[model samples]
Structure formats: C-alpha cells, structure tokens
Target: MSDGVRLNKRVAEDVPCSRSEAEAYILGGWVSVDGVVVEEPGARVGHDRRIALLPGATAMPIAPVTIVVHKPAGVEVSAALIDPAQQEGKQRFLKHHLHKLELVAPLEKSASGLVVFTQDYRVLRKFREDAPEQEIIVEVAGTISEGGLQQLNQGMKVSWQNETRLRFATKIATPGLIDRLCRDVGLRVLAQKRIRIGRLPMSSLPPARWRYLTPVERF
Candidate 1:
C-alpha cells in the first residue's frame, strides 16, 4: 500500500553502494532518515529526502559471522529438508542456519565444497556476474587436455565445445561440472572450498570461524 520507492532502490540510485549494501545498512541499523533509524527497507520515503549512515556504522555493518561449511551431498538448498510444508512455502537448505541473519541465497546441494554464511549481503553482491571484482576459483581434477588449463586461463570465446565452461587461469569450468572434472583428473575431491568471491580469498580466514569484514575487505 506504499507509494514510495524502496530504500534499497533509492540507495542504489543515489549512493555508490549496491542495492544489497543499502539493504545491509538497513538490516544493520545503520540507515537513518533525517536521523531516525528505520528497520524496513521497503518503508516509503520521499525521493528527495536525506538518508545517512550512523557514525561508525560502516566500520562493520554485519555481525562477526562467516561459516565454511562442507555441505554434504543430497541436501537441497531450500529452507525445508524433510518437509517443505513446515517452512510455509520456503524451500529448505543449509542456508537455514543463517536465518537469524536474514541472508538469502540458494546453495547447490549436490556440490560439496565451501559455503559461506554471513549477515553481510553486500559482500555477497560482489559475487554477482556483473560485479567488476568478481572471480570464481573451483578446483578441477581431471585428465584435462595439454592446453586445456591454458585455454581456460585465456578465457576463450564460448563455443559449442566449451558450452558454458569459462576459462580460468588454466582450466575450463562451469558452475555445475566440477565433479566430472574431478573424476577425469582422478582426484577424489576430498573437498572444494569456494576460495574467492571477488578479490576476497577464503584462505585469509580459518575454516568455520566468522569474522567482521574489515574496511579493506570490502570490494
């Protein structure tokens, strides 16, 4: 029943931050209109109204939490695992653990690797395809061609043979075929960690521990 645009939308249009960042600010209680904190990003406000971040709020808008979970096979990313009915129309998945943080993203159940959980959606936004800083590193263990890795590293133009696979530093990878690559390379895939989202390397932190993203960590 509201007539104004959403706070995230307004922030995206006016500030350098993405819509996700604006939402994060609202969720973290950093967003204020004329000085009053507003919890709802959908709240209506004038297009010309002034919005500000609480002093020092940007130091770390999200609480200190980041989990590196080794998702077991066969679990769906929905909100419900056993019975979808219990979730009231929400699908069940591993993301359920971070429900308290209000983060939303579908995880691939069949894949077992690194799963990151955080209240910080802005950090997540960096993984979007359009984000300039985004880069994905998935280990491929297969009998790749002599130049296969090199081809991927060069990012050859997508063709029928390549299909959706994109070239990484020295390998071709798609979002869904890591398992096959592992089989081909004879690697058992003991584990696959999502090592990087944008320039943030997973190696920087210990597994299963959550930490507040430093200002330098913000892409």
Candidate 2:
C-alpha cells in the first residue's frame, strides 16, 4: 500500500475536488489510467500511469439500478439474475447493484424470458400494490381450435402468429395459469415464455443476458 496512492486520492488532488467527488468521477466512468477507463476509485497507482477524466465528463450521482434479465429455460431466476457473466448493458457495474435486489414476477424453471431484479423501492412498491393491474404478455406454442381460441380470449386476449406461436395477454396470471388454461381448452403446450410484463417488453435481449432497466423504464 505504501508503494502507490489510491486513484481517488490522486484524482481528488489533481481535480481539487472532494474525495467523494473523485469516487463519483471514477464510478461514473469519467476517470482513466494510461488512456484506459478505470472505474475503481481505490485502484492503486505508482505515480507512473497517466490519469485523466474524459472530455466534458461530469461526476453525476449514481442511482440505484434495476436489471432486466432474459432467463433461459431450466435456469433458476435467482441464480441467473445475479451471475456476473449474464450482465450485458451500457450501465456501469457497481458491486452494490448486486445486493438487496427485489426479484419481481417470477417465472417457473420450465419457462423463460424477461425476469426483473431491482434495488429501487419505487419499482418494488408498484409491483407490490398494483401487480394485479399489470398486463402480462406470454408467447406460447400449442394447438387450439377457433372455438378454443375464442374461449381463451373470453376475459383476456390472444393472438395467433403461426402454428408454432400463440400470444396471450392476461392480468397477472399464476406461474402455471397459462398452461392450465391451454390444457382446459384442449391445447397441448409445447413451450411457453413471458415476453412482457406491464409495459416492459423483452425486445431483443438474448437468453441468459441482462440489461439495465434505465430511469425512464418501468415495469
């Protein structure tokens, strides 16, 4: 430790800003060492490495993050959501983001797609008090008749994309509700995936990879 100074201390002295501000600069991806961006404020440097902020960089407050992970079939939601390798997004990774995350709208191990884990209390409260009002869009593969489709859409809605895909929209169904509903209608389900929950869609996120749910994004 005596051989080098903490990067935050170096940056703080150079920028003439507070120690906390320097930490913010590093966490915000504004600080670099030898022309390479380094996010760790506690990184040790021996006075040899060139360190500077990017052009017009600002040390803005780092907000709590929400992650939207595309869970793969047969993978447990808890395991998949927290894995470091599964994270894929532009958001800066902070160690704290992995703690105190409230997992929402859990899917079964047999099912897959669009699982959310968040540290934001507002997002948690929304799911807590208004979950029943949220419309869930599930894409499934099965067979059903015109009459059965009519029956399936009696209180909700359903769309037929092809012989291999049928989309169902519902208001907060249980983990196995779709399977049970399809079974009741004589439809044999081959596969099922929840593509959307409330207004958030899975979009192009590949399986097992996750992206940040930005400040503007809501469940």
Candidate 3:
C-alpha cells in the first residue's frame, strides 16, 4: 500500500489556509480530488493527484430547504416519499435536506394536492400562523344545478369553470370541509384534487415528485 497524506493536510498546505479552514472547505463540498468532489476531510490522497477548489465555494452553514410535494391520494407524506432521483430542482440532493423536516399545510390522506415539507422554522411559522387566512383552490368533480351552485357559494366560492369540473375556493376550510360543504349543497363529490395554496401553484409538478421552494417563491 502506498503512503498518502491526509486530504485536509494537503488542502491546508496547498490552499495556504489553516487546518480548520481546509476542513471547513472540504466539509462545505468545495474541494475535489482528481476532479471528483470529496467531502470527507480525512480521505487519503496521493501527492501526485491533482486537487482543485471550485471558484466561489464557501465554508458556511448549509441553508435549510423547503420542498413542495404533490401528494397522491391514500399515500402518506414522509421523508420516504423524497427520493434524490426524483428531485426536479437545481439544488443537489443532500441527506441533510431531509433532516428536521416539518410538515405544513397538511391534508387528509384521502385528499391529493400540494403539500409542503420544510426544514426552515420561518416557513413553518408562516404556514401555521397564516393557514386560517390562506386561500385553498381545489379542483372538484361534481354536478350541481344553478340553485345548488348558488347555495354552495353562500359561504364558499364555487365556480363552474367548465362543463367537466367545478372549482372551489375557500379560506375557512379544514381537511374535509370542502367535501362536507359540497354534500350539504346537493352536490355529489366524484373526486377532489387540491391545485393551489396561498399564492403557490402546483404548476407542472406531478404527484409524488417535489422541487425546492426557491428563495424568490413565497408561501
């Protein structure tokens, strides 16, 4: 076996930084050996191997992630539903992204739609404090008469957007409130799919896949 130096020691010497800074850079995913990024500070490296540090890489705390998931009916929302392969966002999948995650905008297991999982406490707080005031848009399949539609709109807004479906918008809805409201107004519920929450739209996100809530996106 060839005797190789510790990667952090080599990095500290080559980068001309302190041992601790070198380790920090390594841990921050800034350093690569032979063009392959190696995060472990204690990894052994040969003297002849080329090492490069990516430009603008920093040693800093990893930012918490907020993920928007489109849950399918009857499926549970959990970290098990988050697969690195299914990530459609620009952020690289890190195992830490799944840690300390809290669910927000919870829906019944029987209702499918936009749900959120966040590691940031600020996001959690916003969803919790603003839920009662947040508007939810759901696509529902039902048949109703003009009188029934008018009755449905007495407390909640129901729109016959098309001949094929009905759109329901409400700010005072709980998990099963919409269904209960529809039944109360002589409407038969065929299916329900939540399409939007607050100002966030499900957009093109399909069931079970997720993407990062970008810094620019709110709610």
Best by TM-score: 3
Instruction: Name the Cα RMSD for model 1.
Output: 13.2
Error of 2 at 155 (Å): 10
Candidate 2 runs further than 4 Å off: 1-3, 78-101, 132-190, 214-216
- lDDT tens string, model 3, 1-219? 146998899999998888888887887778989999888788899999888898987767778889988888888767777887777878866655777888877777777788788999888888667663334444555566558878877776777766646777766656777778777766666666778877788899988888999999886
1-219: candidate 2 lDDT, tens digit per residue: 246899999999988799999999888878888888888788898788788999977877877778888888888779336666767776657665776877877887778877888888888888888873334444544556558878888777887777656777776566877788888877766667878888888889998888888777766
Clashing pairs in 3: none
- The 10-residue segment of model 1 with minimum total lDDT is 84-93
Q: What is the TM-score of each candidate against the true structure?
A: 0.36, 0.67, 0.69
* Preferred candidate (TM-score higher): 1 or 2: 2
lDDT of 1 by residue, 1-219 (tens): 166688777766766587888877677767787777775778887876788877765524445443333334455443223221222212212222345543322335644333444555564554443432223334433355565544433442312124323322212334454455444534333333344444555454433333334545543
lDDT of 2 at 171: 66
CA lDDT of every candidate: 0.47, 0.77, 0.77
